[model samples]
Target: MLAADLEYFQDVQNAYAALTNLHCIITDKQGNPITQLNNDPNVFHLVYDQETFKEVLNQWTRDFSKINSAIVYDALPGVKVIICPISIQGEIEFFIFAGCLLESTSKNTVQTYFEKILQNPEKANAIFTLIQEYSPDEIQAKLRKINKMAEVLIEHLATQNMKAHLVEQEENLGELLHLIADGNIKVTAVLERFLHENTKLDFVGYARKKGHDQFVIDECILPEVSSTLKGTVFSMGEGTLGQAAATRIVRFWDHMDMDPRNLFFQQKGIYPKSLFCFPIILEKEVIGIFFGGSSQFVRLENDISRVGKLTSSLIKVIEGNRFWQKQSKNNLMKMTALNEIFQVMTDVEDVKRILLIMLDLSINLIRGPFVAVIAKQSSRNSYEMVSRGLTADQIENYSSDISNRYFHNKQNKRFYHQQPVEHITSWSSKVLEIPIAYRTECFGFLSIGLSEQMLKEDELSFLMSLTIAGGVSMHLLEATTKVKMGQTVIDLLIEHQEYIDPDHFKQATKARELIKGFSGFSTYGKINTIAVKYSCYFIKYDEQFLTNKIKNDLIIDIVREYKLVADSKLEFSQASLNVQVLSLVWTYINEDENIDFLLKINGMNLPLLNEFLAYLSHTTVVESEIMVTNKPTANEPKISKHLKLSKREIEVMELVLKGNNNREIAERLYISEHTVKNHMTNIFQKLAVNDRSQAIAKIYQMGLEPEDVS
Candidate 1:
């Protein structure tokens, strides 16, 4: 506790003086006279020996604050004053002085002695007038009364100081607790304050015991030393701190150089003489060690006990903070994964492609071997699926022959299923299957292999939610495909209504009405019938047709107009024509190809007759090999529009094509390694490719030119 402000306590000084009828002055424990309470000048100050009295007063002040009783001292040769020591809590905090009398054998002798000290004969008698002469008995009574009053004042001051000190300590402790609660104050900061306020030390450090026998100094705060000691690790019994850690006890010694194990403070110009080491115990185990050094020998038990209480609490606060930080990081990662999966599902247009992305995401998220999606075929009583590490044939056979034999009804057209129980089967891998259904309609099933660590309960629930969302999105995309197909049929029939036969025209008109009502395929059947009556066939691109097997009279595919260059040489008249034409595909073969061409029964625009044969003309034809290539043409720029890449993905892809690795790309882009990796994955997924090599090849095929990363 800090010393009280004695300069403002003049009332105590005046009270002592008024009761004793003597001038008084007060001073503190350090012997610095605070101030004179009474400043009246008299002949005693003028005639007394001033220089000799000032010297005596200086010596008296230094010797008096510790005294327990009142004592009389000669201020001058014959003049005297009484000094009383004032104490609080058994330690003298202040001293009170009172002027008493001047003594001599006779008035003339007193006058002559004062005249020699003052060097003025006129002031010699004036000094006797100011001095209060008292009998020995009277002086004794006054001294006793003054001593009693001074003691009472000291007791009062002691009580006040105790209250102030208690309040100060409480406030300091409250602030420390608040700092811990905020988590902004570190262990090093707390140690700095504790060492400064509670102990006199040149250096202090806190170290954590790690591994088998290593102690790492995590937070080191030193006032007199400027060298850094943090992150310094030492083996057990290697240094002062290490020894304390090994023994699990407080250690203290002087002559630091005598002990070669003290490595903390040693210099050519300055040597540490003393040091202390102690352990912070929690639950019968030492969690941390405290080490500090001073220039003088410290009280071992007093210093170690004081610091041990502080460090024990400090360790607990540190542990709690680290636990919360770890939990927060885990939660953030989980949320990011969930958000990324949901975004990929709702944003991608194709249902099959979305399933492929989800499979990749789930495999990484669960650290598993494979994930699969099995969708029921629309026109057959079977299932079609996409998977990783498992073939569609394997999935179809398993669900049909092995799984359905016991679990599903082969005759029933629709099946409702929750997740299937695990069992040994003909398949080589274990699998977990959950139904992918939304509301009342069951679309398909999701199959995940049980080859690695299964997800936690909450993670599994999130996975289930993702699957349900995927099913709903797929159902919507399926409905959209059907609507587009129905609209295409309606457009075809309406475009050729005039050329169509009268009966066919009425059928085509009715088909348009059915398509508008969204009665899918029932309307297409009617339109197909009408086209058959006109001797034209409506055919979707069949896989068998790729080998020149023609099962229909009209084949529909997305054939470019330029691919039909051979048709320009056909021989024809306005009425006479007999020819066969074939269209070469120059674009991607889409599964849902739109109708872009119409053919008549006689392969002519107008009716052909035998009478118009005279006008028939022979035409020359040139043939060339038909090839579909994503390779850029001579006139086409290397940067083509076919590769639909986002701006950020394109930036990353350009760097990838330049042969920059993930780390290099992250450095160039000023992003984290994890973010660069995520971008690379996104680029691969968007390009419909797997690794960096495949992604580069696919982009090159789309005429993407390489650019410098810089």
Candidate 2:
């Protein structure tokens, strides 16, 4: 157990983890997980990615070892854990990842993260409900518990390894275990130390089996032999070395002649009276052979057992290096691959494509051979499953269960779900479900067959990034499909505001469901109805590039301008692709004043828009019957934003409404009559009216409409 007596430390680990509600794991210096079966199953609510946690440990060694008590927020998914250096004596022997227990830093942190990133309140709330909320004092108390755990673990480790001194006792078996477990010791170093530390042996040679027929001296301590016997090859079953290779056991020739036993050695003018050879076996097969001889009578029986154990330890050290090295490379590659997948996921809008990326990412994240995504194609479609690494029969079985049970609850709202896999070939058979959702719309869930039930912080966070990406893609695709729904659907949704007939208006009904899926709405008289219209001469565009530029600018202007009022929890789309028209109804939550975003785009005193089309927008304050649910009523008066016309045009319109002529308005304003007439003309053109009477009526209707259009 990670080169320490952790068998005794298992209960301590589980107790601390259960008591503090922080994920705890101990890894050796090189970041390999120390197997502890007693880790509390209920302690972790999210993921416990072994590879990602190892990466964190490696990062600590490289960048944060000095700051051992650092609590890394967003360390794993939405988790914060402090990395404690589990030291023995003065050197760090292991690392303990302790928890402060959070999905985000605080409630405010979660809100801010979702607002700018996914901007999904349902997800934010789901997270809030799962995580154990900690106050300042409570958090401090949890942290103290972590520090105390670290202290106790280190104290126990030191006490356990303090029994014997390595320097005084040369052949202690525990010394070899600790030495090879350091992870930096090379195989050559272990073999060399085996002979160099023993003064009784005159020469040594480690011959690895090549081609299963001959053995070659891959490493040698026989300096007295001629021609550097490092690469010496000999036939098997001929001498002591051959006998060791033949028998797969320790072979000692204590009373043999120096001429025949060291025949290969005597070929190079070397002579030894006694010699011993042994097979280095791994998994019950001879991998190599080690031979050494003495110039005098050696006590072969006394040191044979120690040497056999030493050879086994040597093989493990070599293999351990190779294994960890390969693992490190694979982890780096997985991270790079995950980043690429996440980047591609963000740009993709198709449900199938996004789920495909999620499938690829999930398998790599958990090394799970099978992964599946179960979701509804749309509001009307039946549940479907997308998967990787499963047989057709398995898919059918899983999909039936998931669609009928997982999707059975039409009103299912959850953070996550874990279920035991039946007919398990191993106890490691466990399944985890992370929903792909945005706001409260769950398109489907990522059902992952995990190697273990525990999910890492980094894994959950990484999966969270995928989940959020998929959710956003689903929502954006739905919203975009609705807004550009060929004007037929949009017209139907706008004109027929009553209950929709499910059979006749399928698209409109689905669009309304999508609208309700975005969030709940209440029928109130304060919704901002933002409408954008084009000028009469706006058709002065011919070039494709020029039209594209104009369309892009107008689309940006429409969405950006609409965002002026609703501001938060709003996803807008272009109502008309050709004219850049858009309409979205939203009200501010927890606001005290009414949303009165007045966009007054008049040609008079209008700044020229570089070289492209000039955009003019006028807002109508239509009191909506649909207000966002759970929003505060406005106690303060309405705050009017940008107006339709300039100050001069507004003043001129006021005089016109007051039954004054242009000359009287000019006298009152101290401006020229031409200026007053020009202002009126600009107002008429912007409002798209011909006469003063129509202009006044349009302005009055647009500026202050008190009708309940619900």
Candidate 3:
């Protein structure tokens, strides 16, 4: 029994020895040491102290932090040992104290003990001598390798945790991408979800293009805080995210509080403590930027790498989606262009009108700030109106400037020699050049303005299409302008007989009174030069031509006649008529018609007297008998034409014509009923009318309607 007990004791000693350098001490319940292994026997007494012994025995009841630091005390003369509690049937039996090691021990010797423990004591002792003979440097180097192995084990465990986290993040990212692709998810929603799910990070903000600037926010992910941060500019190199976007790189700032002082954060009120910004690059261009931050400073290499990888992956997906989006947009733009072309072709007769509509459409479609069609001017200074999105004031100013510089200057050879240059305006120094063609005799320059963000190939393509479409629209507009001019000239000739001839004027009045019982037909005889030109050029010379051609065929006749008679004696003759007729039409046409006709013919040439007369005859005619009968009375009526209407009658008549009730008229005119009645009774009797419609009709007949009389 003594030999057996000794063998068991040797086994325990060998087991203790297997943990070489690492002190091991076993103490009984009575606080006496049962076994101790180490070069220093003093470690057993120190480790088996009452306090340490009780702590080791109370493992089941103690917190983990309290038990984690248990180590042999004598290793450093004061350090305690790590204790492993051994129990027998739920009762404290003995405590195994270990983990203290002298700094002088060779790390390889410790490792050899670990390896030898798998084998036996003979092998363990054999390896121990070689390990113990190693120099301090070699032992440290060996310890580093062992530490590296431990680190590998820890890394494996960390990797498992990372995999689980990455899986969840991927799912979240996938959902966000789905929402973005769906297009129903707003930018705010996407950012909010990302920040909310990514509990480890605080989402700072995002940036998007708005007109000529970038719209940035501080806490768009948090709605409660977004309003305070909106409408802020994140210019290039301005903030972390801005810098990242500007440089097209990932930027990591350890501490934002330590950032260099600048206007970016100070003015923008975006002072983050720690920040990570990544550029959302697509097609090698930074389209947007994303930022994540923390309120406290923390460095996470793994997190940085993960974010980089995730951003890169997301960028790839976004780029692919952008490609498809561009394709779809291009197709949609093409279809829209075609539709606009069709609508303009069918809807308008004036090329200028069509061009204007086209400019508006292009501006809206491309979402550009400005659109213009620069066409070759007839004179060095006089470019024809092609199309523009410029305001009236801008058009006038531009036209005046062009006229002053180039109009009719024979020395200006550049007009015939050079190609039109299309330029897009910039907010500051840089002007982005949109690809366009500039050829000699180029129809016009089509220019559009874009937001500060770089445009993609598809956007450029759409712009090119707009320029091309402008050309088509311009052509259509010119053709329509000519047709409308001719129609207007015809309409004037048909209505205004007085400007044609006093005899024809009387006859037209009689004819109109006989046919429509309305003397306003004479108003149509008012002839603008453009109208007379249209009559000369486009009207077929015949009796039917007089009736058909001189009736609303004004624009066509003007352009055709101008072209036909531009160089001949008839050209001069027609030119004179064009001017005289335009003047006469200005004087006699209804106010609305005059305004419209002046707008059309304000800059056109005139026709000669003979052509004007000819146009007038075709346009206006009276019965021969009426002309004969009215010959004597024409001079007298011409004198009476200047008679003035009384202010009261004018006021009463105007209100009556406006359909105002008598009391309302009285209130508006500030007159009593008896006076209003007197004025109305005289107005009716003098106008030769009894009822309201007839009175209105008679007023129109007298050519006294606001537009007609004016």
Compare the candidates by TM-score and give the number of the best one.
1
Which one wins on lDDT?
1
Instruction: Quote the positional error of residue 356 for candidate 3 in Å.
Output: 46
Candidate 3 TM-score over all chains jointly:
0.30
RMSD for each of the candidates:
40.1, 29.4, 40.3
- Whole-model Cα lDDT per candidate? 0.54, 0.53, 0.46
Q: Model 2, 1-710: lDDT tens per residue? A: 54335653565667777787665776676666574533443223333345664576677565545545534445644545666677664577676666535632465675467556646666555544545656667767776776777777675555434323322223433344344434445556656666665667777777877786787888777655555567878767867788777877677766555355667776766677778876765434466776777777767657554544445435533542343344556544544554455446545667678777788777767767677887786634356678887778777777776666546655444433222223232224456777776544567887777665566544654565466556655656665444453322223223222222333344433423422322222222111121222211112223353233333344344445444323433322222221212222122111211222211221211111100011111122223324435532454211122135765676676666555788999999999999998998888888788876565445444443211110
Candidate 3 per-residue lDDT over residues 573-676, each given as its tens digit: 33544433433343233343222232233333322222222233333333333555444343233212432446666666666555566788889989888787
> Which regions in candidate 3 have their CA more than 4 angstroms from the true location?
1-71, 74-80, 83-153, 177-186, 189-200, 222-228, 261-263, 266-270, 282-285, 299-302, 305-309, 312-456, 459-710
Better of 1 and 3 by TM-score: 1
Question: Per the 3 Å backbone cut-off, how many clashing residue pairs does candidate 2 have?
Answer: 11
- The clash count of every prediction, one per candidate, is 0, 11, 62
Candidate that beats the other on TM-score, 2 or 3, i.e. the better one: 3
Give the poorly placed runs of model 2, Cα more than 4 Å off: 1-183, 223-227, 319-710
For candidate 1, the TM-score is 0.36
